[model samples]
Target: MIDLIALRRRLHRHPELALHLPETRETLLEAISSLGLRVETSTSSSSLAVVVPGAGPGPTVLLRADMDGLPVTEESGVGFSSSNGNMHACGHDLHMAALVGAVHELTRRREEFEGDVLAIFQPGEEGAGGAELMIAEKVLLTTGRKPLASFGVHVLSFAEAGMFYCREGAVMGATINFELKVLGRGGHAARPHTALDPISTAALIVQGIQTFVAQNSSPADPIVITVGSLRAGTAANVIPNTALLKVSLRATSSQTARDAYRKIAGLGAAIAEAYGLRMTSEVGPDLGPTVSDKEGVELVRQTVGDLYGAGRYKELTVPEMISEDFSLFLEETGGAFVLVGAAVDGTPHQLPTNHSSEARFDDSVVPEIANLLAELAIRRLNIASETNRWA
Candidate 1:
């Protein structure tokens, strides 16, 4: 068996970002070189898929793990921390290692199942839409047939160790990236009345949007809007011609996200018009929220309860504000995204969350993750064979 801890730490030491993860891919390839399973590579991104054949002919089931790191610098104080200025603050190291471990587990019991186990290692999940790229590159058809169902596991840095959390529908929120620009006249700072300052217009637009969103937001229908970047002028003495504010909107559904974006555009235009300046907003790729099928979530719940006892299973009542491209997999082939808790030893409230510079994950949960995923694949394949479930 591969030393999962050493492999994960090595991956952590050489963290790579976005789609072209050459170093990360090489390490992962070395980890699986001795497994002797059928492998396939992607041309669009640094994504790969491995297939383990079962006893009888049956549909394929996919197990996925994201393979990208974040842009944040590490501050977790671990001995094996990354020094390449990029860190796996989101626990992609753990995800990759656990998936590798699960692949090993399934390989040992290949004859006990009825279908092929397709393990997908995907890169560029942070913001590059690696899932979409893989789908476009025909990575989903690696097993000679489109996957009947796909399953993925995500490790949370702040969640309790050894617990599995999931929800039925809309488990993750949608993303809308917008840039609100106000066109104004540039003039000398000394003459305030002659220049239509966009900085003032931008300030007004930000305040107006925040005020409106706050008044409209509620517990049941929450909308989150954050102005991540704002740029206006190069020098203090001269007023710039334009002011741009890069904003991100998060909501439970696509309709809500589009509605909020429209409202924000309207607010920006209104504020700019009031200031006698033109305003325009452009929206980026709107990746819809992730929704898990009812049957898939139920199967995961049963598998977790039976394997790790019922106490290890926790049902999430609400959707998270974050978003991922994994929504594409669930949409292509119905499946559930399960969360495995691997927080370091600390109070839940005190531990740092994912994407934080101080975030630390417990590598001890790698074996547990492996066991649960292996059991899920076997049982799901058996159920599909018996019932001929083509979903």
Candidate 2:
């Protein structure tokens, strides 16, 4: 048996960030080195891909785990709290351990299965699009194995511990990052007519966004427009020449997400025109909603039910507002993304969420996640044939 708790604590103590996760990669490599498998390291980024061959011929399956930490300081008060400024606020550390455990268990039972397993340890999942990068690097088809399907696991901080959650379509929302900059004349605070104030225009734009969502979007169609950061003048005595606003948009579908983006752009233009100021803005890359395949999701649902009774697996009634880069991988290779609950000591619905400094992940769920991932791979292999492969 793998020592999952000990390995999780070790990773939790020393968290790394983004694609340059050398320490985290090294730790994972060490944990799985003992297993008799072909392991290869990525030259472009801090990533590892392992291949485990079975006894007979079958389709190949991929299992993924992200290995990046956030910039927040540790405040969960765990015994293995990170002393470094970075922390695993989103439970990536648990993800790493669970993937490793799955590899160990699967390798031991290699003769029992009939296909190959491709386990990928990815980096920079928080916002860096690491999944797409790995896909481009041929992480999915590196061993010349025909791709059958894919599977991934994420630990949630707010749901009930040991419970699994997933849906057949739109499990998570699409996201776009936008920046709006308003330029105007700067002058002394005492002067009124001499200077066009951008701060005032920005405030109006923010308020207008709320009304736009309410008026334009339907109640059944959910859209969220949040202005998370605002920057303006350096001093209180003088008005700044330019104001910067960073906004985030989330929607349930691609068309809805595009409509929300266009709405924000229109609001910025209208606000700037009203104040006789110039506006410049840019929309960053958009992550599409993670839509799961009906067959793949049903397979996962059955596997979870077998692992931990039918009551332990929940089919989400509505999509989540947050976005994940795993959507990129699932889009390229058809699969399902399962969320394993790791609620802390408090009420499941009222606990702190992922990315919160106070959020705590239940370590006991590590093995459960491992079992689910391994079973999903085995079950998918049994259903697929070696001739039917994905490019």
Candidate 3:
């Protein structure tokens, strides 16, 4: 009896961002307040860990939904579009609503399943490492037992509506953020010989990144590097004392990610040292490249095939460049991240991508999404316990 469309539209109208989503958290808490499920909130973040105990105790299963909005202005022009300056332009509003529906479905079928469901509403999924923050608080073991496996689904506004896509391992790319600062003596632009030009040194570092990757990495391996931000020099004629450059790297494997980072950092230092300047580099934690467990993925395939037809489940031959903190969850428990298509209106394979101001999703698939999530949890519990996953 839950009106998922209405709920999603309501959330879509008012979007919040990052770990400190008080309004979004309150809205979610109130929506499920009358459900009588056991709920717990995080001390470090505005995350919710809800448990729906079954008729009998066996094992626990983890299901997650991200709960943050991007910093995009509303332009999708939906009737319930957000006007709060923050937008769920990434389809997280649908994700939250679908998970809520899943909780409701699992509660109604509590007697049919014999294990607990741990529903995680995570914040700061955009880039703030909220998943890592929540996991630090030990919410993963909230059922007093390790979950057999975990599963999460994403709504892709650009993909075909109602279809599910997945891959067995490393379905998404692992990401690393590298920032380099070149320190040198500042001087007028006309006096280039008098000053160690950090700007030129930074440019050399960027060029070296491309050449190093091309020389070292295989073409088939898939490595991506983007210069996110570069800032140097204040005035037109004056050279700044330091030049700062931020680079983002994404790769399919951990070894490749590490190799790329090391080279980039080393390249900056090597170029600076040659220019008689010192370069400082900051390397962030290599966050993702969400790996799907073989068994976990099969569970999704079977569940999706049974719920929908076999044609609904699309296998991914190649991994995606997109990264998610959901990888942090998969690190603790085996899981697969599945993408559900939710295009509002578009031809097949052509639609606006998520994170854009024009992104739109079909909330009518909310029921189907809730059912898939509920089934994954139930099936994981049944199979893991039968195979002695904990023992």
Model 2 lDDT tens row, 1-391? 7799899999999999888888888899889878868998887789999987777766688898999999999898888899999999999999999999999988887887787888999997877778878888878777687466788878889989999989998888898888999998899999958999999998998888888878876667899888988899999889889999998889998789888888788888888998899888898768899888898899988988887899999999988888888887788778898888999788888988998888899999999898888888887876774434432
My TM-score estimates for the predictions, one after another, are: 0.94, 0.94, 0.91
RMSD of each: 1.9, 2.0, 2.4
Error of 2 at 312 (Å): 0.4
Among all candidates shown, the one with the greatest lDDT: 1
User: For model 1, how does the per-residue alpha-carbon lDDT over 1-391 read when each residue is reduced to its tens digit?
Assistant: 7888888898999989999998888888888888899988876678889998889789888999899998888999999999888999988898899889989989989989987999999998887878888988888888888988888888888889989988999878888888999999999999978999999999999898899788887889889888988999999999999999999899898999999899889989988998899999998768788888988899999999998899999999988877878899999999888888888887865799988989999998887887888888888899898898754
TM-score of 1: 0.94
Task: Name model 3 segments beyond 4 Å from true.
Answer: 187-194, 233-238, 347-350, 385-391
Candidate 2, residue 33: the lDDT equals 79
Cα lDDT tens digits, model 3, 193-248, are 99988988888888898887678766678888888789997799998899999888
- Supply candidate 3's per-residue lDDT for 97: 92
Candidate 1, number of clashes:
0
In model 3, which residue pairs have backbone atoms overlapping below 3 Å?
none
Point out the higher-scoring one by lDDT: 1 or 2: 1
Model 1 deviation from the true structure expressed as Cα RMSD, one decimal place? 1.9
- Which order, best to worst by lDDT? 1, 3, 2
Q: Name model 2 segments beyond 4 Å from true.
A: 385-391
